[model samples]
Target: MQPTESKGLSSSIFISRCRAVWIHIGEMSCSSYKVKRISGFDPPPARVFAWRVLELKEQGVREDDAMAVADMEYRTQKKAKKKAYKELKEIARSEGKKPPPNPYPSAIKEIQAEEKKYVMDRLFNPKVIEIANKMKEERDKLRQDRAADGL
Candidate 1:
């Protein structure tokens, strides 16, 4: 094989591999890609809520009514789960055994608790509120001073 022929043969092989990769990528369904993208980023609770609402809509429920119904159903299920866990804990206490671990521990609840604590400390605390008020007053006084100087 001459140098030129070998170069042509290698270039063809490279072009074919590139074409194969493009063809494989094109074979993937756009709808499936969109579904994967949505499901990947959306939280499970949000997906479940949307799914419930969709089911209600398919059953001829109005949009507003479907959302309300889905929210009510989700809250009811959460309350029932809490009550069942409480009952289980009480039974374990009465039997003098170690309480079973919570079967449905929620990261969302923990995050909310942390957020509440941060807000209470930084936003609602009397000292913090007083400091914020003082800063605002100083800013207002500075603005007034600047206006007077401009005048």
Candidate 2:
């Protein structure tokens, strides 16, 4: 573009106009380009399902109701259902006078054991350590090769 001396519009005004025109043309061109649709299909039905969480909020439903709805719709396993139910019941109990049901002993024990295993694996994972060592060795070899090449 040619540099303007004293033109019809000031330099900054001219630049802004150019930017606006460019953006308008770009947007028009992009709008003309066809975007692919994901699929001509509907979503699968879940046994339990909640409406979109945002829609619930917009409709001014209580937080507990929204979460419960979401969990019921989305959670597939019995364990997940139990967890969601327990949480909802607990919240309700806290708000009211009734005490929440005691969780089943077997389920509680299973949950505890699973949790313990998760913690142990996170803290001391032999496979992870082996992988880390191998990665460090590979990186060191690459560094050595680079140094030899004066890179």
Most accurate candidate by TM-score:
1
Model 1 misplaced stretches (Cα beyond 4 Å) = 1-43, 106-151
Whole-model alpha-carbon lDDT for candidate 2: 0.50
Our tally of clashes for model 1 stands at 0
**Candidate 2's residue-wise lDDT over 1-151, tens digit each?**
2323443322211123111111112112122222233577533222112223334534666656765665555545557767877887888878996755554446567889779976787568998778778999999999999999995
Residue range 35-115, candidate 1, lDDT tens digits: 233545644555556556556655667768877887788789889999999999999999999999997788898789779
Residue range with the least summed lDDT across 10 consecutive positions in model 2: 18-27
Candidate 2 residues lying further than 4 Å off, grouped into runs, are: 1-123
lDDT of 1 at 7: 25
Model 2: pairs clashing at backbone N, Cα or C within 3 Å: 48-73, 49-73
Clashing pairs for predicted structure model 1, backbone only: none
Instruction: Output the lDDT of residue 46, model 2.
Output: 27
